[model samples]
Structure formats: structure tokens, C-alpha cells
Target: MSYEDAFAAMAAGTDEAVANALELFPSEIQTISIDGADHLLITPQNLDPGLANHLLIHVHGGAHVFFSPETALNSSLAAAHAVGARILSVRYPLAWKAKFPASRDRVVAVYRHLLQDYPANQLAFYGGSAGGGLILSSLQHLLAEGTDMPAAALLLSPWVDVSGTGDSYAVMSGHDPVIDYPVSLASAAREYAGTLPLTNPGPSPIYGPIESGLPRILLTSGTRDLFLSDVARLQRRLIDAKIPVELIIYEGMWHVFQTSTGLPESSTAWRDFARFLRTAWAID
Candidate 1:
């Protein structure tokens, strides 16, 4: 299939996933607009009105080709229930429809709009895979612009180095059963990068200056994840810069295994995330 056709085929598969997510994690989804952009506001079961002041913004990850704001409800619901707060899943334009800074800029705009009613400390961001990478790069964009920082962020199996400049890419080529880098994965990166160079630090935040304007970040990856090296390198870079960061590695798990939710490992990851957010928000 052509690149465009491949992306379409990938997107076409989102319906069943969204349906499954709904059935697996029942929640209320509202389409709220930030200016003109529509985002998914998920109020999962066990939501606490007392924690209404705290907000979680999510960006879904599907190699920037699959999954939309509404389609990302599975994890959004899981996160809302985990933290007992509402989540706004940013509906940034996908790579196939818009490339490069479009995803980053749209998120920045949504954040800026939300800043009107909520203090930066009241907000936190989370995403997995491309979504996590997008959050990282968008923060880079915000940093370059000298914007206020949020309380913290959770990046689950983040694909920080979209340039594919990591040891795991080579080592886990045959190991990661979920992601086949040699297949259409590279092409998806190209689709996301478009005219931009893969290493511009826009598409690949690993090359960006993350030393400042960043809140504490929690990054998780598994030994079998293709982006394990990316997470490890990012952790080292943050530590070298004296940034408050936490790295959690799970054994025998692959990219975004936290989404499985049924695994004991996934439960631990979410509980750890809850503690991280509690500390960031100063919630006892």
C-alpha cells in the first residue's frame, strides 16, 4: 500500500479499538472545544469532585498516525479513575493529516487556552508512545517560548527519539513482537516528519534542550520495548541536567504494556503514577 493508503488503513483500524476501549473501561466522554479544536473530556468512574481542581491532559499515541482524541478514551478513562480527576485528551492533528509542528503547536495552543482558568500547577500531562513523544516535543516548544510549566508529566513508553537513533531499535528489532520497525514503522516516522528533518528536535525531542521549563517527569518503559533505549537516554540526560525525573522499567513488557491494565505490572505502573501525581500535586 502507498504511504497515504497505509496511514488510512491504520486509521481505519481505530474504530474497533475505540469500541473495545469503551467496553473495557466504561466512562463518560464529552466533546469540549478549546477555541475551535475539540478535545475529549473523560470523567471516569470513581471521579472525585474534590479533586476537580486538578486536571490531566492526555495525548494519545499511535505512531502519530492512529488514534484520535475520542479514540484514546481507553487510557483516558483508566487515568481519570486512577487519579480520581477528569482528563482532557488533546485532539491534536495526526501526522497523516498534518505534520511536524502542527501536532506540537495545537497542544501548545490548547494548553495556553486552558491556562486562563487553571494555574499551571493544577495541570499535568500524560501520553504513551507517539503521544508521549508529542508531549515532550510540545514542552520543548513551550520551553523555547518561555511558557509556564505544569506540575508533572507521565510518559509511558515514550518514543522520544523519532530519528530512530537508539540501541534498542537494532537490538529489539526481532524482540519486540508489537512494533516492527523495519516494516511500516519507519514510514510512519517519515509521514510524521514530512518536510522536517527527523532530527530537528521538533519531531525528535531527544535532541532538544529539556533542561529548563520542565516539571518533574515520570517515564516508563519495558525491556522488550523498542524505545527502551530512548527512555534510558532521556533519563540519563535529565539526571545530568539535575532535572527531577523518575524512570521505571518493567521486565518482559513491550511498548505501552501499561495499557493492558489487567497485568499486575500495569497495576504497579498506574499506582506508581498515582503516587507521582499525588506528590506533584501535593495531595496527601
Candidate 2:
């Protein structure tokens, strides 16, 4: 099916469909409290008995308003097996209760706690869409405070600019069947950001400074995604800063196409992500 068609199928409650689709994978789903809020965690059922030297922390996407770790189980499990790493899918605060720095701070707290037990060089951050924006924003916060960055990062169709200035916003609008464009997304961003300026790097990473010494970054986006311009702008900034950056732009695909695990495009996206993780973690 085409990306648009797949997204339509997904928008019609595909989470339930994907959950059933992923039953074959050996995995566990549960919740853990981070900063007094319940957050979800998904790990493989029989993760290699050995303590994983590497960990993958995933933040979920819902325009900063909806969904949680449970909705992303299929791709999360696939990534765990492909990379030979443990996965921690965080349940950060949503836009309704908290706002801007609240969600970002929650993830940072979890990362900080993880660092106490794992080496900084062995932990990587992964997220898609709004989650991708959070990963980058969180890194910027850590860097500003002189904390160590992750070993690597994987961003899939990141929504890096809430200001909505990206050129693709118009080009990919109706073409992207998943998101409805500036109408819903912009309104949600406004609610999540509260009084904070959308241009603030803490809220929108694309406008933030590209710090040196960050971990290797692998960004994935579809040519048809509304945030295509955001990804492109981020790529240019990171490349200019001499950061190790790799971008995979899928032709004719829409936003977060990989969310539909049953589709062929979704499989390809996951494989590429797995390969990126394997290499990043030095997994043989």
C-alpha cells in the first residue's frame, strides 16, 4: 500500500492492529514512575542473559499530546532485537498537564538516572516525530549544562520546528495522510509550549545551536513528510558543525510511515534503523 493509504489505515486505530501484529515477538510491557509520573517501559522477554552494555531510550510521539510507549511496541521490539540492546520507552509528561520543559525535563531525569548505572558512551537516544524533537531538545539541555551526551541518536521524521516555518509544511500538507498539518499540530504545540517561545532551542531544536562533541546522529524522514524541511535544516546545521550525521530520506513516504509495522515500507525503515543501532553500539 502507499504511505498515504497505510497512514489512513493506521489513523483508524492501527495501534490495536499493530499490537496484535507484534504478538509473535517475545517482549514485556510495563510502567515505571519517572518524576512521580507513570512511564511505560518495553523490553524483550528473554533479552540475552548478559547485561547489555548498550541501552536505547525511546520517547514516544503524539504531537506532545497523545499516545504513549504502549502505542510504539511493535517498532520498539524490532529495534531491540536488531540492535542487541535493551529498550527503555519513557512515558514523559504530556502537554495537557505539564508543558514544554516539563516533558523535556522528565526525560532528562530518566537519562540522568540511567547514567548512574550505565556508561554514558553506551546509551543512545531514539525517537520519531515529536519524540524526535524531544530527543534533540533534551540533548541541547544536557549540553548547555555541561552534561555528557548520548553515544548516538536516531531521529525518525522529527518535528524539530514548532514555529512551522519549514518550506515542506505546505508542500507535504494534504499529501501526508497521518498529520493534518498546521491546524492540529500547531495548536497542540502551542498548548505544549505554553508561554515559552516556540523558537527556543529547548522547545524546538532546529533553532538551537549545534553543539560540538554530540554523539553520532542518524536522521530518517520521508520526502513527503511535512517536517521534511525541518529535517533538512537540521542536517545542514549538523553537517556544517562537522558532526557525524547520516540522513535517510525515503521517497514518496509520509510522516512516521514506519509506525505501520505491517507495511513493506515500515519493514525497510526498521531494518535501516536496526543497522544504524548495531553499528552505533558496536554490536557484532
Candidate 3:
């Protein structure tokens, strides 16, 4: 099934159709509310509550229009496993229903709430695709409001350039297994942007300022991923701005390919991801 088809299935409430199309993970899922939005706490069954200090706030990817905390439970668990951290996965308001800044606002609010329970330096953000872009957007909002930033972030093939101006969008067209550009990606960006221009830095994030005081970020993208160029662009911008950043380009993987747990490359990526988190958290 195409990414667009899966999204439509999800939106149409065709549970079995979408469920059969995706791989899921086993996690202890808990439903919670923050700032009037649904949020999920998904943890490894053996997760220790004492490690709450090392929190991973995940933003599930769905092109900003598909999936929910429930639909994305397994993917969120994969991240929790990769980082070895308890997760507070944000089920932020989706686009097509609520537009630009709605998801951003709710994420920031949840981040603030999480901050009250854990120190800013102990928190981390992880997201793939649109969720990855939202990671940057939420940080931009927090920074603009003078709120404390988290310790670090991980962007899995982040769709940072909502305008779809990246070269990979064209260059890697047929090579990419997921994400059909111009049509699939651009349409989703429009739905999410609503009345806002796609170039609006607050919503697009790639157009946002990259400077000091933002959290250190680790970004991963496959060479075949359509968002590779956007991830590369943001990495360079971060480095140019003198912010700490790391970019890992998988030789021939597709967008967020680490979710394909059966692949040996996926295992390697997860190991690297875990190591990155440990280094960022200053954990041995």
C-alpha cells in the first residue's frame, strides 16, 4: 500500500486495513491528557520508573495528517527501545482537522508540563517524518517564548522543508520506497499549513533560525529517502550556526527505515541510535 493510501485508510477508520499494512511493537501503553490533547505514555514492559529523569518525548510521524498515539504505539515503542528511555509520546492535534500551530502549540504545552516533572537537561525529543519536523517546530516555539530547551533530539528522516524544495524530492523519486513527493508530501504540507505559507518558519522549521541555545540534535536519513536533502540542509545549517549536530546517512535505506526491525541495517541503526542517546544524555 502507498503512504497516501495508508493515510486515507487511517483517516477513514479502516482499522484492519491499516493495521495489516504496518508492523507494530509490544509496549505498555497508557493514555493520558495534557493541555486538553491526548498523549500516550508507551514504555518497554521492563522500563524502570526511576529512569523517568531520562525521558524521551516522541512525536509520531504520519505526514501530519494520519495516525494517532494508538495507531503509532508500536513505532513509539521502537524509539523507546532505541533510546532506552521511557516515552511520553505526543498525540498532537492532526492536520485536516486542526491546522498549523495547533500541533505545535500542544507539543510545546506538553513539553512544558514534562519539564516541570523532569529537568530540561534530562529530556529528549524523537520523531520521524512530519513528527520530526514538528520536533524542530516545537523547539522553535519554546525558544521564541524563552522556555528552557531540552538536552537533545533525534530526527528520523525529518521532513524539515515543507515547501518540498529539496533536491532529493526530485532526485530520489523512484528510489524512495515510501513518500511520493509533489503529490503525497506537498498535499500533506498544505493541509497542515492551512492558511499559513509553507515557508512560514514556525510551521516548516527548515526555514526557522538555527542558533545557539537549542538542544543538540542527531538526525538520520537514508540516501534513498526523499527527505535526505532536507535533513542534510538542516544539519549544515545547525553546524554553520555553531550548534552541536550529528547526521547519519544510511547507504540505501528509505525514510525512517529503522522501523523495519527485520532488516540487519535496521538493527545497526538502532544500536547507533542508542549510542547517540547515551552520549547525548551523558550516560555511560
User: Which candidate comes out best when scored by lDDT?
Assistant: 1
User: Which prediction has more favorable TM-score, 1 or 3?
Assistant: 1
> Which should have the higher lDDT, number 2 or number 3?
3
Candidate 3 regions with alpha-carbon error over 4 angstroms: 1-8, 11-26, 48-50
Off by over 4 Å in 1: 2-20
* TM-score to native of every candidate shown: 0.94, 0.90, 0.91
lDDT of 1 by residue, 1-284 (tens): 66567656766766676676677667788889985788988877777777788889999998888777765666777777778888999988878788888888889999998899899999999999999999999888887788899999899989887788888999999888779676747888988999888888889999989795588999999999999999999999988888899998999999888777578987788888888987898885
How well is each residue in 1-284 modelled by candidate 3, as lDDT tens digits? Answer: 64467766776663543353233444666778889877888767546454657888889898898887766654676667666678888878878778988899889889999888889888889889999999998898788889998888988999887888878988998789878777677778888898889898977898997878899999999989998899989998999989899888889899989766568888888888878877888885
Candidate 3 lDDT trough over 10 residues, lowest sum = 14-23
The lowest-lDDT stretch of 10 consecutive residues in candidate 2 is 2-11
Per-candidate clashes come to 0, 0, 0
Q: Which scores better on TM-score, 2 or 3?
A: 3
Which of the two candidates, 1 or 2, achieves a greater lDDT against the reference? 1
For model 3 the local lDDT of residue 265 reads 89
Candidate 1 — which pairs collide? none
TM-score (C-alpha, index-matched) for candidate 1: 0.94
